[model samples]
Structure formats: structure tokens, C-alpha cells
Target: MTAARLISVNVGQPRDVELNGEIKQTAIFKDPVPGRVKVVDHHVDGDRQADQVNHAGVHKAVYAYAREDLDFWAAELGREIEDGFVGENLTITGYDVSHAVVGERWRVGGVEFEVAQPRIPCWKLGVRAGDKSMTRRFELALRPGAYLRVVAEGEVGAGDTVEVLSRPEHGFTVADASRIFHRDRAEAARLLAVDELAPPLKQWARKRLGLELEEEGG
Candidate 1:
């Protein structure tokens, strides 16, 4: 298969916006950067997450969404969607982000990244789309994109070739993660097999398997 390519590098800062008649601060409004940008351990150099408590972390330092998915949405919504419209840090082409497996390592430009988990839609996404049901729709569509952890800090820019260096044997993919998060709560073993998954996802799996209370008590 041909190498996947980074279509755009996007960055944004937190800003206040009115959503559902309430003032809210969000960093979902991103614009493509013109040149190479630094990829750090915690986040991209020019990007910031408004909700540090839930959004920004080592496990979710960067978000990648497929350009094809954006095109799909554009057709579905009957409107043009730009590269960073979905709040992705990296807009990628030639690969299915939803099929990315946890622990899969990708080398892009000079940086290396690991697939950490699938994104879980929040109210902010719905607000950004100007529809309260957008979150539910995103969850149901099961194409919520993938979050990545920076394994090696380096500079990256648009048109960088993405090389897959490794993939885990567990076979747990981002689509499977989304299924476990949304519909299939019985796949605890599959969820646990992805050892590199974020702690929150692991906890969700434990809860689905009725092990959270037991583990907590012990």
C-alpha cells in the first residue's frame, strides 16, 4: 500500500463562544498552519486544549482525522468542510483512521507517534457543528477519528509521508474501540488486549465488565 500522507497541520488556541445560549470556551476551531510545526510530548507547539482536565494529555496529545471522512461528512451535510473543520491536529489521507490499532507506531516527517485511542465525542463537537445531536450522530457513525501520543518530538508539516513502523498483535482497532465505547459493552477482553490504550478507556472497559467496583474495593 502507498504511504499515508499528512494533508494539513492545524493549530488553535482556546476561545470563548456562545453555545446553546451559554458562553463556553473551546479550542475546537483550528486552522491549517503554513509551515513545519513542532510536535512536543504533551501537544503541538501552537495548539492548546481548553479543557485540560479532559482534552489534553500525553495519551491524546494530537488528533488525526481522515480527509476522506471529511469528504464523506461534507456530502452528508451538504456543505463544504475544510481540513481542520473536525478539530483534528493532523488531517491525513490514504488511510482509515478509524481502523488504526492501539500501539501502532507511525513515523511522520521527523516525528514518531503511536495510536493511543479513538476520540469520544463531547458537547463541544456538537456545538461546533451547530447541532445538538451532532455528538450522537458522530458516536453512531463510529468514525470519531483517532488520538495519538507523540513518541518522538520533531517538526512536521503538510505533505509529510506517514510510515507505519509497527502494529500490535492484539487486533483491537480504533473502530473496535468506538464500538466498545458506544454499543458493544461486552468486549472487555478485546478492550483490555490493547495494552497501550489510555487509562480512561481502560477504566471504561473495566466498568463494562463489572470489574471496576471489585478492583476499587481490592
Candidate 2:
């Protein structure tokens, strides 16, 4: 059995959104996304003015390792490692976290979360990277990362171990879902049926597949 490794976990408060000279709450996995709980707005240079929505709620987003990356304004930023990412409420390294398909389930500590959707890179990441092109880099990787829908309803902290509890029957990994959803909608249709997609993802899939899921009879 392949074991998923817990690489690093990070949580931080928005730099610009300060009150009385005090930092707000550190962002968490289930934190409310302004209008939505699962959705999060990202900024590159710690600038609140340059934020955008690329990754939808409950979507897992991944950032790759790049050495040439440098901060545009280093004075205002916090400690960042070469291969580490800061936006995600939770960070993971091993266990092919990015390749997890929708509908697949995993457990972290006592909390259970399921892969909801493949993340779509937004402008906020570009700001974070100090280069708009970095957004494309993340998108090109296709392993942008993943979002987990809480199943057990529990609080998760850094250093928690994640365990794979179930994998989808179709075997449609996150990478596959990203390509199929954009390049080939028909194939995506098949995946949505089996994948545990988030609301936005499910909506996208239903429209692309032209297969409306009938509600179960009461």
C-alpha cells in the first residue's frame, strides 16, 4: 500500500485586511469565502486590491516547485519556502494528492474529506507568485491541487496525517478530470457521474454532459 506523506501545512491571515493594527483570523480549510464558505480569493503580493476568483469552492488547487520565483515586494510577505504553498487551508505532499479524483475519500486525523473538484487557476495566484505568468505555470502543471469537502465535520490543524479511505470506480484522477472537463466535455460527463464533484463542478459537468441527474424519488 502506498502511504501518503504529510509534507507541510500552512495557515495565514490576509495582510491587507487588518483591524486596529491587528491581523485577522488565519485562513482555514472551512473558512467562509466572503460570499461562499469554500471559495477563497487569492492575492500574489499581499495586495487586497488585486484579488480574483479562479479556483471555485471545494476545489483543490496545487502549486509547483519553482526556484526562480521571487517576491515583488519582499518587505510585506511572510516566511515562504521554495516548494511550499500558502493559499490552501491545508497542504499535502505525498499520496498523489493532486491526482486524487473526485468522489475519492481521504481522512486527515479524525476529520474525513473527499476530493470535490480540480482547481482552476485564478489571478490571485499570479499576484502571489509576483508574476502573472505563474498562474499559467500552475495551470499547466494540471496538478494545481485539490479541495476536500468535509465529511466528518471536524477541525484540522497542521501536522495531521491524511489517509486514503476510498477511490472512485472510474479511476478518473484529478489530472484526467482537468483535461476532460475543458478539452473533452463528453469524457467529463462520464467522470462527473462517478467523481464526487463540488457544486460548481457538478453544474459544469451536467451542462457539458447534457445528462441531468434525476433526483431520487422520495
In terms of TM-score, the best-performing candidate is 1
Tell me, by lDDT, which candidate is best: 1
Superposition TM-score, candidate 2 onto the true structure: 0.62
TM-score of each: 0.94, 0.62
Residue 25 lDDT in candidate 1: 98
True-structure lDDT of candidate 2: 0.50
lDDT per residue, candidate 2, 1-218, as tens digits?
Answer: 53454443333344433334554332222121221122133211121221224332234332211112212213224445332442654545445656776678877655577777666665546555555675666656565466666566543444456777888777776677677755666675665565366666666677666667645571
Model 1 steric clash pairs: none
TM-score of 1: 0.94
Q: For each candidate, what is the lDDT?
A: 0.89, 0.50
Off by over 4 Å in 1: 214-218
